[model samples]
Target: MRRSRDVPLLVERARAGDPRAVARLITLVESGDDLLPQVAAALAPYAGQAQVVGLTGSPGVGKSTTTNELVRALRSRGHRVGVLAIDPSSPFTGGAILGDRVRMQDHATDPGVYIRSMSSRGHLGGLSAATPQAVRVLEGAGCDVVLVETVGVGQAEVEVASLADTTLVLLAPGMGDAIQAVKAGILEIADVFVVNKADRDGADATVRDIQGNIALSERGPGEWRPQVVRTVAARGEGIDDLAAALDKHRGWLVEHDELRRRREARAAAEVEAIALGALRARIGSLRDGTELPALAARVAGGSLDPYAAAAELLAQLGA
Candidate 1:
């Protein structure tokens, strides 16, 4: 285990925009190693400053292209950017598929950009369990914006909304009909609807379909209405408009105090996840020792109800 004193030097290097130090710090968080608490303690003062943006859609909707272009756009404005691209894990090897990383190599030479691809490791909801923590590392490393691109699973990808300050649901024309889009349930989680490949045919219809659906949704006065932005990301068109819309959303979040509320909710979820992880570790320690298997046998034989067995386990943990 590393002492708390040993983490500050890495943290300081990361704060000074040393990519190797930032990568090392994030690697520790992602590995869930014993040094995590000390790293978190070192990073505690520097996080909560980056704007987290999430991008999700079905596969082949140009998510990688958009992310690449978006990074360029942000960089053009002198903002340091970090990208956490969640890729589906290879079941045999437990490694990332690396397709997204390959596409994002345009930024490989830029000192201000850091791009990391993480395997989802069979976690549902299109994100890795370590994603939020990795975002904290990037935030502490002084990224102005951290863009999280999900694994591109259709409906389950909505989890990003809870983790991101703003969620962009990307759509490409002719990928599927508008009804198919609604069935994915992406509408409910979208803070912005991006119609990519806008130079293609039917892009206008796609835009109109989204606009109509959003208009039908019920809302009160002063609600933050999601804007539809069209982009040909490959050609760098409409990116400026998309960036402006991001700024507008940021302002709206601050003006309405939504940022504070969202951060509070995010923090609460992080605490809950950590507590659950600790409980799981404690349970694992008891599994083969004495309590768990005995309880299981009793329940299996109908001598003890499952609820009672669970109560016993909880009592042991609490004790």
Candidate 2:
């Protein structure tokens, strides 16, 4: 356990761009330890400086490759980048199962870029519960841009939309049916769409399909429409265009005042989740054949409805 007294020092060091200190602070967040509140408080003032960009897609869509190229492009423009690559968890060790750390080794020698791979820990939304806090740590560390690359599990990964200032949905040609993208609800969340591996056959077809889908979806007047860009990430082709699209989206967010609104909603959701987690922990303390089972039994017997039983449990907890 990190001493609570060390939190201020960590936050200061992180703000000075000490990668080690930044990493340690993120570890404390991920551990959900007693030190987290102190760390959050210390970092709060320096947070929210970085632009968060989320990259998500189904598995095998080359998200790691795209992230590497995106980092390269952003760095060339003199942006200090931070990457949070969420990888699937190893069941035994609860550590990252994927080799994103290896894949992003291109930036390993660059002081201007910081990359961290985190295990999803069986989280269903393609991100670990600790991701938002880790992002705040990166922002406080003076990263100009923070790229959140999700675990890329299908469907549930849509949660990334709420977490990023701009969400890029990556799709590769022939990887799957184009309709699957719609089914995954990616269309609703995407601020920009990247047809990666554009050198491949059927790339144009994939782009067309996405364009057709966007046309079918209704849009409000003055709403920022999602733009599509093509990229061959491995070859570094079309990356400049993708970067331009991101800039355009950021400008639109600012112009429409959507930036403030989105961030407020994000904070609200984070607070609610945290409060629910604390409540769940308090309930867990009574799991030794206490109130929960008695309530369950009553509900099972039909003498008490589930909603009424839930009310009883909340009252027992003084909710």
Candidate 3:
């Protein structure tokens, strides 16, 4: 664990564009040891300037390719963009795959662009616990745009929806019936949709399906109706329109107090989640047989009801 005093130096180095120092700070935060709270508290002052955009969908939708193209487009418009590509955790190191080095091919030499691939770390939302902190770090370093790319496995996975100012849900043609049946959350959370891999067959049909879904869900014309833009990301087609749609969503967020309220709610949720997680970790350590998975198994066996077990464990720990 780092000494708490190092946070200021780390922040200064990070702000000065020292990637090593920034990387080290992130390491200290995501390592799941001591100093997590201290690091989050220290970085709190430097957070929230960047607009976080979450790119999420099922695999084979070419989300990373689409994201790479979008980065190039956003940069062409003179924006400084940061990308957090959250991949599967490396079991050996309990860290992320860190495959972003190969995936984000275009921005290597551009000093204004920064990319980091994180491990989901068994975090169900497709975002690691460190993700929000990483976003804050990029915002502190003056990144005007931040893109979070998820693993894109789960149905209706919308982890990024609550975190992002706008969430881009990518879908490709021919995903078929099972994938298509995913559900309302994914469709409902999209601020703007992207029909990527548009050159493939069924592209037009997929567009219409999403359009019809959006129409069914929208309450009225006054509600922000997210537009589905087609793109062959590999060819960079429709990149301009996608960027424009993101900008339009940002403009709407700027005008809406409701969006600001959502941000507040998100912040509150983060605080509560962290507090509960830390408290559970501390209290569980003090009690025998109170580990999360064990308790879950016991509950599943009907040996103990969940509420009673939790209360009993907490009481046993004097928590």
Q: Lowest-scoring 10 consecutive residues by lDDT in candidate 3? A: 92-101
What tens digits encode model 1's per-residue C-alpha lDDT throughout 1-319? 2565658898888899899988888788888888887888877786678999988876667888899999999999999999998776645322333655677999999999999987677677657778888998999889999999875565446678889999998898997553374554666678898899999998988898889988988767877888899999989899999999899999999999999999899889988998888889998999978899999999999999999999999899895
Find the candidate with the highest TM-score and give its number.
1
Model 3 C-alpha lDDT per residue in residues 1-319, reported as the tens digit of each score:
2577777778788888877766776677667647667767767876777888988877678887898999999888888888988775546422323344576767887888888877787777557877888888787676899998875556325678878888998888998552466665776788888998899999989998888887777466456788899999999999999999998988888786656777788899888888888887877665554375677789999998999878866766677
**Best candidate, lDDT-wise?**
2
RMSD of 1: 2.3
**Colliding residue pairs in candidate 3:** none
TM-score, candidate number 1: 0.93
Give me the overall lDDT of model 2.
Answer: 0.85
Q: RMSD (Cα, Å) of candidate 2?
A: 2.6
Question: Residue 257 deviation, candidate 2, in Å?
Answer: 0.2
lDDT of each: 0.84, 0.85, 0.78
Worst lDDT window (10 residues) for model 1? 90-99
lDDT of each residue in 1-46, candidate 2, tens digit only: 3578878888888889898998898889988888888888887886
Q: Is candidate 1 or candidate 2 better by lDDT?
A: 2
> Compared to the true structure, candidate 2 yields what TM-score?
0.92
Candidate 1 residue pairs that clash: none
Q: Rank the candidates by lDDT, best first.
A: 2, 1, 3
TM for every model, in the order presented, reads 0.93, 0.92, 0.86
